[model samples]
Target: MKALFIGGTGIISSAITRQLSETDGCELYLLNRGNRNESLPANVKVLQADINDESQVAKLIEDLSFDVVADFIAFRPEQLERDYRLFHGKTKQFIFISSASAYQKPLSDYRVTESTPLANPYWEYSRNKIACEEYLIKQYREQGFPITIVRPSHTYDERSIPLGVHGSKGSWQVARRMLANKPVIIHGDGTSLWTMTHNRDFAKGFIGLMGNIHAIGEAVQITSDETVTWNQIYAAIADALGVKLQAVHVSSEFLAACSKEDYTGGLIGDKANSVVFDNAKLKRLVPDFVASTRFDQGVKQTVAHVLAHPECQTEDPEFDIWCDKVIDALQGAIASVKGR
Candidate 1:
């Protein structure tokens, strides 16, 4: 099978790229601007063109076609439009990496499946993803576009630890605080259920859908069955870092009001709410798919990788200061209430 991945070097797609590159009789091509070409496997071919530049990409891949083309970076419907223009009838299968967050916000039910209504008013990112899914589904229905929608929920890799609440830079600041014994903020009492899947595990199920005729025109969510609370997630990170969890619980609304970043979207729209994915559809489609990495094991590996690689530990002093400020204000509020 021949597969082409657009923007392949990312947290989720990177694992898929690695999986396909190693599979027997599989030919893989990565279409990107050649930024992290060195990180890819040796067998994977490189198409050195920006996916946004339609003409340049068209010229580059004029004579080539693939069994699969997966786009990881396309966030908006316009991007999907560009993909349709570029790869219409060019590939056997087109996989859109949609987010599970595109599922209904403040869901009527805690369990999320592909059938979950697409609605997220708080985050434009999720709304755009929802739109992209709708467009691709329409294309599949109207034009016989061989499209497969795979929604991933909070998938993590070795590069970064997954967390519900964190600053713009990344989750490194929170991990740093854990190591320093400083209080880290967890939104909403830290008991909300969240599922975190390792990218490697996500790769297994995604690969199953590559040339799968059954998967075309279907939307499937692939996530781990393991559900852990936000508290357990932070505790795992702190355990991995060999530090005690000094966590300060704060309201999601307060955190949104305090931060300059789009916490309203990142938190309320997506991570703040409890989500437990029903991977029954994914299992039915990919009979062999299983998410083997537990949260503790995955996060432990992630924390160790970040500790070993100083480059990954890029400190965010501004976020750190902001965390301290939030913690201090919360403490002051407690003091004032006690005085009253």
Candidate 2:
């Protein structure tokens, strides 16, 4: 299989890159700015060009055609428009990495399938993804663009731990608080269920879709069937850190009001809601694909990787301070009510 991945070295795409590179007959090519090409496999060809600059990217891949082209960085519909121009007839399959968050906000049902409605008014990111999906589907239906939409939900790798409530920098701060024995904030009583897929496991399902005739013209969401509460997710982090869980539950509304971050969208619109994805569609398309990583096991590997790698241990003091403030204010409110 000859495949090209745009913006390949990310939390999700990096794993795919690695897996495909090691495959017996896979010819993998990566197109990006080439800043994060340090640890990629030597067999992989690197095309160093910014995808935003269409002319530059066009010239770079003028003579090269791929069996599959997956775009990991396209967030807007205009970007999809550019991709259509660049790879209209050049590839047999075009996979757009959409988000499962594109599923309806406050979903009518907790279970999600490929047929789930694409509507997310609460998050501009999800809404934009929906638009991108719409554009690609139109292209496929009207002009046979050969597009396959793959939606990933809360995928994590060894580089970063996944969490419900965290600041802009990422979930490292939340893990750091766990290590330091500081209280970590969990939104919406921590009982709302969520699913986190290990990126390595996500890679298996994604690779199955590449150059797959069945996946073309279809939107499939690839996620683990395992669903755990936000509390259980955080507890796994604490267990990985070898510390007692010091969790402070806060209302999603209050957290959104207190923080400058997009808690309203990231929390209420997405994470605060209980979501269990039905992977029957993925299974029918890719019979061998199964997400084998449990939350506890994956979180342990992630926490261990973060601890061993200094680069992943980025300290977000500002977010840490903000967490303290949120926890303190909640405590004060509770105390005041008790005194009254």
Candidate 3:
């Protein structure tokens, strides 16, 4: 079968392309902005086009068609709409990559199925993804556009890092800090439960679901079955690195008091005790889906990747600023409380 993958330059999509090329009887075509094509397979065809531009995308699709279209980076509704306009009738199936954040629930719920309500309209990223999913489902039911949605949990490849106090990056950052023998920074008690999935496993499961007719019009949560707390995650990383887990725990009340002036920093305190998602539906859909890499194993792989490729280790400036803000808030709270 012929497959056209959008945003093929990313780490996740690159793995998918490699897997598809190795599989017999599968033809792969990558449609990217043409920025990073060095690691792509020689046998895989490349199409240079901006997916955000409707005219260029439509023109590209005028002559080319595929049995399956896997979109790895459809973050905006406009992008999804452009995809629908370009390949709605031409492609046999559309597989959209969604996030577990699309589900509005705590992590401790034990199981959040496809039936979970999506994030509220105020969350820009999750809301946009849900809107795209809703649009695709509507098209499939009314206009017969074959569509499947896959919601992956925190996916970490060897190249990823935890950046700051929040987000997937933040989690990785905490792990890195622990690995570095630095104190693990905890905003509030550090009892929040979360899960991480290796990108290669995620990509494999995603590809397996591509042409499965029964998967159409369904949202499958792709994640590891293991659930862990923030403290446990830090301890695991430290243990893997052969280091001690030294943590500086801050109270939630202190963080709340500091948040009066710095809301973003204080918000991290609340997330400390939150449970994010449950991936039971994924297990049921792909009963054979087994996560080969554990969190510690994944962390070691990530550390190796960072050590080998120094360029990928540079921290994002925005994350640095956010971290500074949180630190400042914490310091101010300590001083204020001491003065009282």
Candidate 4:
């Protein structure tokens, strides 16, 4: 089977490309921005095209017909609409990489399934994904578009620096700070539960769906069954790095108040809490789909990777600015309380 991967150069997509290349009887093709071709297999055909350009994408798809198209980075509605039209009647299967963020969460609720209502107020990200899923399903019903949607939780590879658990800047920042012997910053009392998945396992689940007729017209949650609190996750990382998990936990109430002030550009509270996903549907489809890397194991791998590659250890500027604003608001709040 000829499998074409769009956005195949990403961390998760790289894993998927490797898996496809290793699988016998399957040939892999990659269509990416062509920025990072080093990790890709030499035998795999590479097509350089800007995904945002419809003409470029359409021209490429017309020439190289694929049995399956795994889109790793279709975030916006325009991107999805264009890609859907380009591959509408041509491809056998259209696999979309969606996110658990598509569903609104009160982590305490736990066990959210594919059918759960998506409560995304800031739909810029989640709404667009949900919209694309809806569009694909519509196509499946009317035009028989073989669409399979996979919603993965916080997927981490050795290279991943996920922001949900490690703060807005991601775990990479924490790893860098730990390397510098600085205290790790914890947002919102360090009590939120995080559901993280290994990128390898996530890639395998994506591959497992290939050409499987049962997976078509269905959405599956690809994630680890276990849930870990933020404090525990940080402690595990600290243990791995042989550093004390000395973190300054910020109060959610303070953050909410800070998000309101102009100086801090308003506070952003944890709208989602203690949330977990039910991947029973996916497990039933791919019975042997088990996450091999535990949270601690994944953390260790990520830390080791960061330690090995100093170049990969850069801070996210946006997150740093946001953190600075929050800290400013926090100091202001402390002063106000003292004055009162």
Candidate 5:
């Protein structure tokens, strides 16, 4: 099989790229901005160009085509439209990476399947992804444009830990708070169920559908079947870091409302609600697909990787300060109401 990945060197797609380039019996080409110095296998061809510049990409890949072309970075309808124009007849499959967050917010059911109605108003990011998926499905139905949509939820690589209450600086800040024995936030008493998939495991199900004809015109969510509460998720990370779990509980809505960026979408829209995915569709399509990594196991690996690498220990003083303020204000509010 011949495959092409646009924006391949990301947290998720990098795993797929490595897997394909190493042992899929497939010729792989990774097109990216050439900014990162990730050590990829030499056999994998790198297309160095800005994909946003259509003319530049066209001139670069003059006559190239593939059995599968997956775009990992496209988040909007316009981007998908560009892909429809570029790879319409050039590939056997065009996979659009969508988000499980695009699933209906305040879900009607805790269980989500591929057919779960897509609607997310809290997060513009999720809405944009919903729009993109809609556009692709439209193209598939009207023009027979071989499209496959893969929705991923909270998938993590070795580089970062997946956290629902992370600050603007990303998961690293949460890790730092853990190491420092500071009070890390876990939204809404830490009881919402969420699933996190390891990148390598996610790659297996994803790669299985790369050249699959049955997957065309289909939407499938690839995620771990194992579900954990927000409390357990934090405890696993604390366990991995060999530290006492110091979690401060806060409402997701309050967390979002307090922040200038208003993470209501990521927090309230997505992670605040419990979600258990039915991967029966994924399994029916790819019989061998199994998310083998347990949270207790996967999180330890992530924490170890980040701890050993000093470069990954980047700090977020601003977020740290904000967390302290939120904690203090909550404490003060409680005390003042009692006339303390």
Candidate 6:
């Protein structure tokens, strides 16, 4: 099988690339901007080109035909349009990486299946993804473009410990707070249920969909069945670091209004709500798909990896100050109400 991955080295797609490279008779080509220094499998080749430059992309893959072409970075319909023009007849399958956050916000149902209606009025990012899906479905219906949509929710790898809030410094900052026993901010009272999938486990279901005919014109969310609360997730991380959990629960609405713009989309619009994914569709399609990594186990590995590496401990003084400000504001509000 000949496969090409556009923007392969990401939180989710990196695992898929690793899997594809090791698969028997699978020839994988990574199309990226030659930036990140990920040690990919030796057999897997690199096709260096900027996907945004239509001419460059065309020239790069002009002579090659692939059995599967999975794009991991395309977020808009225009990019999908470019993909349709480029790989319409060149690839057997074109997989688009969609987001589970694309599902309806303030959802009508907490359980989301592939059939769940795609709508997110609160976030333009999800709205754009919804538009992209619509464009691909149109292409599939009208032009016979073979397309499959795979949605992933809160998927983490060895490099990251997935969390509800990271301030502005990213996951390492939250991990730092945990290590220092400082109160880590958790949005929405820390009770909202969330699903976090290890990228290694996510690879199993996604690789099964490669060159899979049943996946054509279908949308499937590949995630672990394991569900945990934001509080539990934070505790898991804290436990991994051998520290006590110090969590400060804050309102998601307040976080959105006061924090960065990403809070509006990445938090209130998506992670704020509890989501239970019905991965029965993925299971039915790929019987071998299993997400075996428990949060406690995966989180331990992530924390260990970050601690062992000096580069992963990213610092953000501004974000640290922001967190303190938010906590202070919450405390001030409480004191005023109590007449203290």
TM agreement with the true structure for every prediction:
0.99, 0.98, 0.84, 0.87, 0.98, 0.98
Alpha-carbon deviation at 162 in model 6, angstroms? 1.1
Candidate 6 residues lying further than 4 Å off, grouped into runs, are none
Q: For model 6, how does the per-residue alpha-carbon lDDT over 1-340 read when each residue is reduced to its tens digit?
A: 8999998888898888888877899988999887873688888799888898989999888899999999999999999999988898999899999999999888889999988888888889999999999999999999889999999898999886788887666788888877888888999888898999999999999999998989998999999999899989988889999999988999988988887748889987899999999999999999988899998999899999989987888877778878899999999999999999
Badly placed stretches (over 4 Å) of model 3 are 105-110, 162-181, 240-242, 250-280, 315-340
lDDT of 4 at 144: 84
Count clashes in each candidate, considering only residues at least 3 apart in sequence or on different chains: 0, 0, 9, 7, 0, 0
What global local distance difference test value does model 6 have? 0.89
- Candidate 5 global lDDT: 0.90
Per-residue lDDT of model 5, residues 168-277, tens digit only = 66789988888889999888989889999999999999998988888999999999999999999999999999999998999988889898755788888898999999
Q: Give the TM-score of candidate 6.
A: 0.98
Give candidate 3's whole-model lDDT.
Answer: 0.70
Cα lDDT listed for each candidate: 0.92, 0.92, 0.70, 0.73, 0.90, 0.89
- Spell out the clash pairs found in candidate 3: 106-275, 107-275, 107-276, 107-277, 162-169, 162-172, 162-173, 163-169, 163-170
Q: Worst ten-residue run, lDDT, model 3?
A: 261-270
> What is candidate 1's CA lDDT for residue 211?
97
**Candidate 4 lDDT, tens digit per residue, 103-189?**
763333566888887656543567678788888778789888888988887777777555432445345666666666765556567
For model 4 the local lDDT of residue 247 reads 72
Local distance difference test, candidate 1: 0.92
Which residue ranges in model 2 land beyond 4 Å of their true spot?
none
TM-score-best of 2 and 3? 2
Kindly list the per-residue Cα lDDT of model 1 for residues 59-178, writing each as its tens digit.
Answer: 988999999999999999999999999999899999999999898998999988888898999999999999999999899989999999989999999999888877778889888888
